[model samples]
Target: MKNKPAFATMEALAAVLIIGFLIVIFILFIHPPKQFADARNVRRTSNVGTILTALNQYIIDNGAGPPGVDGIWRVLGTADSGCNINCAKKIPTGIEAAGCLDLTPYLVPKYLLNIPSDPKLGKPEITYYAVRQTINGRIEVLSCGLESNQ
Candidate 1:
């Protein structure tokens, strides 16, 4: 009788451990943290597209580039905190190493209701978004704060 009780306890413990392991596997593989990361990436892609479209429309309407668009990556957002003009240092990669483009005056109310920010670290001072015009007049806008190894 004593041996039977011990065996039952061991079996119970093993079953619990297996259930725990399966739950962990379900959380890790079946349902992953990557879902949130994927959502953020989607927002970033949408933001980039919105910014690009706004810039293109601005160019079409005005027949010229918005301010501070000299073929360099300009951080998009309001300028502040002693980094009045070029806030490239704010970006992690610091692609252009130049100014922060304040498109609020130009884009807001006309091209866009308001400038879009990064899904994670967006702010008015430095939106974590970047824009630049290529030499061929192609405009590029991207989210500088891409997440999940992106």
Candidate 2:
């Protein structure tokens, strides 16, 4: 009789442990928390679109594209990026060494209040590259439906 009770107690403990594990799994599936990875991707993508639109508006208001590479000329002057805070060194074009320019300066006259940042990009900064175009063979604001992986 003593042995029978001991065996039953062990069985009950095992059953309880199994049930607890199943419950944990169920909870995880039922209310999935936002993944930082996915969140960062969404933010980065959306920000790219938003900034692109702002660039367009800025250009429409102004005559030409912002100075320097990637409209980053704003960084040298102590102005705001309007999308987010970017003290970016100029994006290189064909390995030109003097190509150090911050991309924020192009969106002038309040293009954006604050720059959108990628959550996963090590410091909540944008990691996408800009595509610049020329109007009548003159450089203008940035453009990007498909950007580079910088």
Candidate 3:
């Protein structure tokens, strides 16, 4: 009788351990770590800040902002043709632009070596966007990245 009780206790413990292990696996699958998303968001914020700083520097050096007929220069190329100014119409989504901006005057090896693409480049639903705001005839660069929202 003593041996039987010990055997039962051992079996119960083994079953509990197995169940715990299974639960852990299930949880891992259901709720994967969000580190990747968090990291991407951080990168997006950094990239936006970098671009904004470059734009500010460009303005200081040139005494005027980049050329834009309507004061709105969409970053990146257009979605369909990846053409910057030649695109038929502008799309609001930042990820769809083929190029970063038409501010070539500012990018002559001075402002930025290369434009920074979104961390999630191919995912057009989320990307970096920039707009030049003119207040009192002074140019201000405003930017937002999709990852920041996440």
Candidate 4:
């Protein structure tokens, strides 16, 4: 009878409501697949680490590491674009005197392919904070953890 049609309508409405609820849940719990900056921060830190190692090596071999402005820019294959031209023979202005010293100058190496810029913050604006220390008489570079706040 008429009741049957009413029940059918209610069923459809209920189904629609359920679908809407699920959609809300999906939006709340299921994030769109995207590479967030937090995920890319690891790579940035690793690149920083690599640069630190290279600088340490440079110091060990030359009796002095690259200039300590922000730190040292990586000079790829002796290109002299980053630290080579700027700091190899002389020092460059890097960082506010109190800010994290720029490290891009000492990262250059004959085998290093290129300067690994931060993927999240992009080049020249490296948001990662760093600190230099001598651990057990060895130069150690420390960086802010996942949040880059160090």
Top model by lDDT, which number? 1
Writing each residue's lDDT as its tens digit, candidate 2 over 1-150 gives 335455578799999999999999877865444454445556656766776677667667876555553422221222223322232433323222223234465664388655544444322132333435444533332212122332
The Cα RMSD in angstroms, rounded to one decimal, for candidate 2 relative to the true structure is: 8.1
TM-score of 2: 0.48
- Sort order, lDDT high to low: 1, 3, 4, 2
Per-model TM against the reference: 0.75, 0.48, 0.56, 0.48
Which window of ten consecutive residues has the lowest lDDT sum in model 3?
A: 83-92
Candidate 4: regions farther than 4 A off: 1-19, 30-35, 69-105, 109-111, 125-137, 142-150
Tell me the whole-model lDDT of each prediction, alpha carbons only.
0.77, 0.46, 0.54, 0.47
lDDT tens digits, residue span 1-150, model 1: 335455577799999999999999899896666887789889989988998988899999999889787687777766644222333334444655444679899899887888887767787778878778889999988776777667
Best TM-score among the predictions, by candidate number: 1
Error of 4 at 14 (Å): 5.2
Q: Give the alpha carbon lDDT tens digit for every residue of 36-101 in model 4.
A: 555665676787687566766777777765555223322222222322221212123432233334
lDDT of 3 by residue, 109-142 (tens): 6887766666765233223444444556544433
RMSD of 4: 8.7
- Model 3 clash pairs are 76-99, 76-100, 77-97, 77-98, 77-99
- lDDT winner between candidates 1 and 3: 1
Least lDDT summed over 10 consecutive residues: which range in candidate 1? 80-89
